[model samples]
Target: MKAVLFDMDGVLVDSEEYWVALEEEEVLPEAVGEGVVDDEEITGMNYREIHGYLDDHYGEHLDIGREQFETYYEDAADDLYSERVELIEGFEKLADDLRDRGVRTAVVSSSPLDWIGIVVDRFEIGEHFDALVSGDEIEGPSKPEPEVYEIAAAEVGVDPADCVAVEDSENGVEAANRAGMTSVGYRTEINQGMDLSKADHVAEGPEELRGLLLELTS
Candidate 1:
């Protein structure tokens, strides 16, 4: 593989739990106040799926409808992304090493464009990535669907089969598999319960991820 595709939230940054906590602490309480759905159900899905879950469980509590979930999340995400989001350890150095080796990289996220912007800017990864593809920017569905990875591979000018994808959730592994790409599953404390067996490789941390990437593309 000449290029690599990454899932932005849990893979590139340690911000997935921050987002889930927002839902549990603020959004879900405002939407259900009791029990709508646990973090496991909505954690790996995109905003659209999360909104649908809310609508099915406790739609009345939501001030806005499905059409407005994206906007609401975008607004809420800025605070979380800017305030708490941090790049995975050793990510900058790994990215530099990959670039030095002539391996291109890009981001494929289930996040909205605004949230992705916040992450990209906060981490200052603008120069490291050759492209960014947000689920919100595509017409198709998010992770667990192949569209996001397809777009990401295209953006990096590489065939899906020839690109290595790094992901941190079950949905992300499914998406990469469906896209006909090899994937490395990232295991972090925040995503410890997630199933990652679908990935071609499983990594416990950034160092392991870098080693796997190098082994794959070398």
Candidate 2:
């Protein structure tokens, strides 16, 4: 592998728990209605695209408008990234390991650049990545559509087929696979039950994921 693209929320940092909590507690109830939405539908989607997705797929069930959905996520962004989340175990070492082996590393996420910035800046690990790719900045669709991962590969000057991606969301794994990368589904406590069948392989936790990436790219 010429590069390793990591999905920031779950793969590199344990932020999905916060996002899922927000979705389950308040976001979904106020936007798409409690029984109408699923975690997989918006977990890896760009925040900006989620309102439209809910409108298109479950408009009849909506209890709120686009503005409210947008407001909920935007308002939660700061605390979720800056306070509730922690970098996944072994990520700093893993990034350094890969880079020492001459492999490029990047954070590729469906989140906007500002959220991503909050993450890297808080962890003080922003220097580890060769590039920080955001879904909001992509020209086309984001995760599950492959454009974000494709762009990440290009930004790192590596062919998509030669890049390996570690993702913790269903849409993220699908996006990496569709981009022709070596896709590894990363499982954490928060996503232990998620279906990652689309991945080429699955790693159980941070240590396993770190080992797998090292071996795959070695």
Candidate 3:
């Protein structure tokens, strides 16, 4: 592969639960009226898509507008990701290996820019990636829509077919698939319950991810 696109949460960093908690604790209670927009709704969606889910489920009860919901999520996200999020083991080494092979690397996440920035800064993995595309940077849509991965490929200047995407959730796998790239499933603590059967390859851990990538490119 000429390039690799990585999803942030549940793939590179262990921040998926952080977001789930943020929704359960902060955003949903205030916006969705105490127990609306459950974990299932939050699991596979990006922030914008999450907002739309809330609108569809609990919009009438919200004491705010769509922009207000966005702001609340944005603010909560800032607080949520500020804490030190742990990096997946061996990912640094794997990233270095990919770089050493002259492969371009980038992050294409459904997270907002600030959240991705915090994790990137915390882990100091910013230097490893050639590009970082947050869902917020792209207009109109999120994961499972293909646009996000397409944008990442464009930014990296690589053909979609030449890139492999690493994803943790079904929506992310679908996004990568729709973007015309092979996608490796990244299963982690946060998304252990998720079904990853649709992925091009299933990696149970960071070490497995490294092995899979090398094997695929070999």
Candidate 2 residue pairs that clash: none
For model 2, how does the per-residue alpha-carbon lDDT over 119-186 read when each residue is reduced to its tens digit? 98988998899999997768887788999988899899999999999998889988998999999999
Q: Could you arrange the candidates by TM-score from highest to lowest?
A: 2, 1, 3
72-129 per-residue lDDT for model 3 (tens digits) = 7677665656664678888888888888888899989888787888878877889999
lDDT values for all models: 0.82, 0.88, 0.81
Residue 178, candidate 3: Cα error in Å is: 0.7
Residues 49-112, candidate 1: write the lDDT tens digits.
7777677776677555566666657677778788877788888888888898899899889887
Q: Please give each candidate's TM-score.
A: 0.88, 0.97, 0.87
Worst 10 residues of 2 by lDDT: 32-41
Residue 32 deviation, candidate 3, in Å?
Answer: 3.8
> Which one wins on TM-score?
2
In candidate 1, which residue pairs get closer than 3 Å at backbone N, Cα or C atoms, i.e. clash?
A: none
